[model samples]
Target: MNSAGTWATVTSGISFSQFENVLGVLDVPAMSKNTFLKKEVEVEKVWLKHIDNALVEAGIEERRLAIEKGDVDDGMPFITVIVDGGWSKRSYGHNYTATSGMAVIIAERTGQLLFLGVRNKYCCICDRATKIGMEAKPHLCYKNWDENKPSTAMEQDINVEGFKMSEKMHGVRYKYFVGDGDSSVYAKLVQNVSYGRTIQKLECANHCIKNYTGHLHKLAADKTFPPDSRKLLKQSIPRLTAAARGAIRHCADEGETVDDSISDLKNWPYHVFGEHAQCRNYFCQKVESNENLKIITNAKLLDEITALVSRLEQKAPRLIKNKTSNAAEFYMSLLAKYNCGKRINLGQRGSFQRRCYVAGSERSCLGTKPI
Candidate 1:
């Protein structure tokens, strides 16, 4: 049990379930704990107790910084926060689920996690305790354990509660919320009195790229494009979108105002797709010119690219809140690993919450290592 628990912390949360698997592939019966599966519940109980202790330690660190800075009421000194949610199945083939929401404060200068918050969703049965006329999810009686709130509520109780806790602890709400264009989270922040003031929304660059390329793939499927041209265009989507973003940034750097930068971004595809392309000025050699590209001269494909650019421009910021949700996504992977790789045990709610708390603590210590 001691070895398994230590291994989990050392690996930043590879669960005890992986212990037997690791030993099976290794020659080290020396480190082997054959009882990991049999003693899983006890091991997790020990692990979770430590996680609670770690959270208290992190909060103390926050308070120490606050006292030193003489700004106990000023909130972790962050104007922006990146927020995202993740969900995983509790068991391999079970209806039970685990959902968590996380928020990370980023330093303006260094862009590191100044603070992190994680909250797990709770499932409960609301008999006569259930509110009348409340629309909850089919499986969940309450959205969360708190006040038996309806399960389908917009800002998920866990996520909003996490933010509210941060505000109380740190003393100020983030001025700008960065996320993957999930309006529900944003809407909740906007509606909250603590966070509503001068709140700006930033869509993640990675999500923006994913969304922009979706349209490109749709255009690629049109039969109007020849097979070869379709292949070329499909391959070009990422390159083209990257170049478009670069152009927008370059325009801003060259003293263009936000409106001008957005205007330039909106008109970028039309100006760059032609033989005498203006992309070379900003994106350099990213835009490849091809005689075969003439095959895509169909007005429909051109219009599709135009619309995509317009949509991209609207979502793409002249200065993003954060470059990507890579940190958030990587942290989610870490959470999964703690839950025992791809297979999670949703059987015990407390166990899942312990995993979540441990993952968040480990993430805080990690400080966004390369990737």
Candidate 2:
């Protein structure tokens, strides 16, 4: 029991020493050193194996619950999933790059994690065997690698591989693949898979908003507009994004068709800044006043905003349904904290590093009841 509790603590991003201190402070009787002959190495191996088993079981259980609740059809098993990756350098002087590619299927209606998958290339067999007093063996080598130009292409393949495995093991028939601006993710997922062409790509709205805001920021730096007006325009970027999100939500609530939603979204700029009085649905009360409109008199700034609106309008069909990857972002934050926050190497190049994964999977499974 103490061993299990200790492993659970470590899985939750707590250092082992901190776990001991916490237990000592709480007057909890933890495992004694004699339990395993003080073999820290063996303890970690056993704990990580347990975590891996638990993750697999939790995914299967989640799929079962979703089926029972009719969230996933027993025959179809289709789900909506979000994809993201974590890249970190160990800060060792060598400038090595290690990327952890992750995929998570969350409840479409509730946005809770259903399954999580991760891949990284840190499993060099010769390096491991040499550490354990064994001869180098190339036969045991396995790599989650791609020989494509621009190594980041490997990230797309890893993500697709993980998703496909989830489909096979958990009966995941993904209906939507939510991600950021990376076009490669969509292209890769659609090639050579069962539901590839059927999966719809949903771009994260927060990322889109950030991109628009960046364009606005650059435009605001032009020095042609009045400095005071420039400040107002800079301040308006957030308001613009918020208003656009509200408009999208309104269309979604009204059950607007894709074409209608895109049409409505295209009018966001006019609806926001037009000469309308206190219309109750207006995001800004002062838009009716001429003084507020004059602050954005700069032709280039307004054009940039128009361009942004036009782009969003074109993508409104996708953005109208689900607009954010906030859940996936939250999970990734936990993964990072578990990995390198306390200076632990849990996110190191190999699959044996399960702390980050354990943190994500355990929290997803236990933090909330199946919904």
State each model's C-alpha RMSD to the native.
Answer: 7.3, 5.8
User: Could you tell me every candidate's TM-score relative to the true structure?
Assistant: 0.68, 0.72
Query: What lDDT tens digits, residue by residue, belong to model 2 across residues 237-320?
Result: 676777777767776777767776665555555445554443334344544445555556444456667777788787777777
Residue pairs in candidate 2 whose N, alpha carbon or C atoms collide under 3 angstroms = 122-349
> Judged by TM-score, which candidate is best?
2
State the C-alpha lDDT per candidate.
0.55, 0.61
lDDT against true structure, model 2: 0.61
Stretches off by above 4 angstroms in model 1 are 1-78, 90-156, 224-229, 248-256, 277-280, 284-294, 317-322, 368-371
User: Tens digits of per-residue lDDT for model 1 on 216-268?
Assistant: 88888888666776776776776677766665556545756556556666655
Candidate 2 stretches greater than 4 Å from native: 1-75, 89-96, 99-101, 109-115, 123-143, 146-151, 224-226, 271-274, 277-287, 342-352, 367-371
